[model samples]
Target: MRAVGIAVFLGLLAGAWSQVASPVLRPDCDALEVEEAALVAQDYMNSQLTHGYKYALNQIDEVKTIPRPDGGENYVVEMDLLETKCHVLDPTPVANCTVRPRQETKVEADCDVVLSKVGGVLSVVAYKCKSEPESAEDVCLGCPQLVPLNDTSALQLVDASLGRFNRVLDNDTARFALLEVDRLATKPLAGTPQYLAEYAIIETNCTNDDDDNCVPLASPVARKGFCVAAGTPAFTAAVDCALFTNEVAPVDPTLNGTGPVAPPVVPKLQTTHGLKHHHRLSSVNVPAATGLLSESEESQEVVPVVKRQAPMDTLLELPVVPAVPLPPAAAPVLQLCPGRKRHF
Candidate 1:
C-alpha cells in the first residue's frame, strides 16, 4: 500500500512537470493572414465608400498583431486613404461615374481589422474605417476628466488616464492625431502617483505643411509626456491646464527626475534622415562690411547675402555649438603658515 501511494505521487509530479515544460501553441499569423484581414477591411471600406463616397486604395503603412483576451489575435493594418469623393456616382464604368473635381476632396481614414479563430477557423471579428472629418469642437466629446491621482483607485487609474489621452488625440482639432499608445507606465513622483505615457502622433492637416491660407496651427511636436492626475472635468480645458501645469520630468523616476523626456525616438523616425540643409545667396544685395554704402557702389558691387532657405517640407538644421569643457577643479592648497598645521 505505501509503494502504491508513492508511485501515484510521483506520477502526478511528472504530469505537472510535463505541463510546465511543454510550450503552449499559440495561433501564428503571417503576411497571408494579414492579407486576409486586409480583404475584410477593403470590403468594409467599399461599403462605406459606395453611392456618394469614393476612395482609392493606398499602400499599407503598418500591420500589427494584437493578442486578444480569448486566445485570438487582431491584425491592425494602417493604410493610406488617398482621396475620397462626396458626390453620387453612376453604376456604369464609362458613364457619369466620374465624380466632379469640385465635389471630390483628399482625405485620410484609419482602419482596424480584427481577426479571431474559433475551433481552428479564422474569421474577421470586427472591421471599421473612420475618416478624419473637418475640425469641429464637438469631436472631443467624452474626454476623460482629470482627478487627483491619489483619489482614484489603482485598479482603474491606468485605464482612466489612457482613455483620456486617447480621446484628446482622436479629436480633429488636435495638432497631432494620436496613432498608438506605445508605452504607458506609472511611477511615483515625490510620493505622488504619476503616469508616463509614450504615444505616436501623426501630422494631420491642421499641423501639416500646407498653404499659407490654411489655419495657423501648432507643430505636431513631442509624443511623450509626464502626466499627473490633476485637473477639472472639461476635456479641452483640462488638457490645456495640464499641459501648462503638469511636471515635465523623466519617464522613469528611478533615473532621477532630471529633465524632460526626449522625443521622436521611434524606429521609423530614427531610420529616416531629414532633408539636407542648403545654403543659398539671397536675391537682395547689401553693403559689405561698411555700415553705409553709396547708391552707385551698391549697384556696382552687390554683396550677395548668404541666407538659409527652409522649405515647408524640408527639415531645418540648426547649427550645433560644441559644448565648452569646464576647467578641472584647482588642487586643494594646504597652508601651514597662515593657520594651524594640518595633522596627517
Candidate 2:
C-alpha cells in the first residue's frame, strides 16, 4: 500500500510540473512582454516610410502570441492608426506632433505586424499596412469638407503654390512640375473658407515657365517630393515640401529594343510598405544636383531633402532599434503596461 501511494504522488507531481513548464499559446494582451513586442513592431513599421506624416496609434484591434518549439514566440499585432502633422524627416518627436484636425480629410492606416522574440530580444519579422482617406463629413454635421480633385478653384490654388515655389527657388538647373493632386479640402478659419492641398511634384524636362506641357525627366536620376499647401485662391498661405531621390535608378524598358514604349501612369505613392515601382520617361538632361528650397517665408519651415539609400524592398529588412516611448495621450490604444513605456 505504501509503494502504491508513492507512485500516485509522483505522477501528480509530474503533471503539475508539465503544466508549469508548457509554453503559453494565447498570452494576455496586457502582459508586459506582449505590450513590449507590439511597441517594437510599431516602431519598425514606421521606420520603413521615408515620406508623409507619421501614423499615430489609434487602437489595438488584436494581439496574439504563438509559441515556437525553440522557446521563442511570435507576436502578431493588429492596429489602427491616424495621420499626425509630424513629417518623417522632421526633428520633432512624434509624441509632440498633433493629430490632423477634423476639418481636413481623414487619412488612416491599418497595419498588421509580426515580431519574433528570442533570448529576451525582439525583432520584426514582417509587416504590411493599408491606408485610406475618408471625407470629413462629420466636421460640419454631414457637410462635405473634401474638395473634388478636379475642382477648378482647388487646382488654381495648387498651381499658384507650385509657381510660388519655383519662383522662390529660381533654380536654373531644374524646374519642378506638378505630378499628382493628393488631397484638397475646404475648411472655415477666421470666418473665411480656405483651401488646403496635398500634392506631389517631380523634376521635369521643361523649364519653370513651361507649365503648359511638362513631363518628368527621363534620366537615371530623378527628384520627387510631396508638398502641402494652403491658402485662398488668390494667394498661397504656406507651402512645405520634402524631396527625395532614389539611390538606384530604375531599369529603362526601351533599352531592350523589343516592346513598344508605354505611357507612364502616375505611380502610386508608396507611403508605406509596397511593391517596387518603375517610371519611364523620354531622355533628357538631368541636372547634376537638385537644388534645395529655402525656408518658406510664410510657413517658416525649411524644406528637407532626403535620399533613399535603397529600394522599398530593402527598407523592410532594416534592423530595428530600441523604441522611444510615445505619449500615452497620443495613442489611447492599448492600456497594456500602465506604468511602462509605449510607442507608435
Clash numbers, per candidate: 0, 0
Off by over 4 Å in 1: 1-32, 48-51, 66-73, 84-104, 117-122, 133-344
TM-score of each model, paired residue for residue: 0.24, 0.53
The C-alpha lDDT values of all candidates are 0.34, 0.58
Best by lDDT: 2
Cα deviation of 30, candidate 1, in Å: 10
lDDT of 1: 0.34
Write candidate 1's Cα lDDT for 107-187 as tens digits: 344443444544444544444344543233422333222222233243144344434554553343334343333222234
Candidate 2 has its poorest 10 consecutive residues by lDDT at 277-286
lDDT of 1 at 278: 10
lDDT of 2 by residue, 117-223 (tens): 78877876655566766544445553337666777787899999988887785446567888667567777777777888877777888776566576787544667
Badly placed stretches (over 4 Å) of model 2 are 1-32, 47-53, 86-98, 103-105, 119-137, 140-144, 169-173, 188-193, 205-221, 242-344
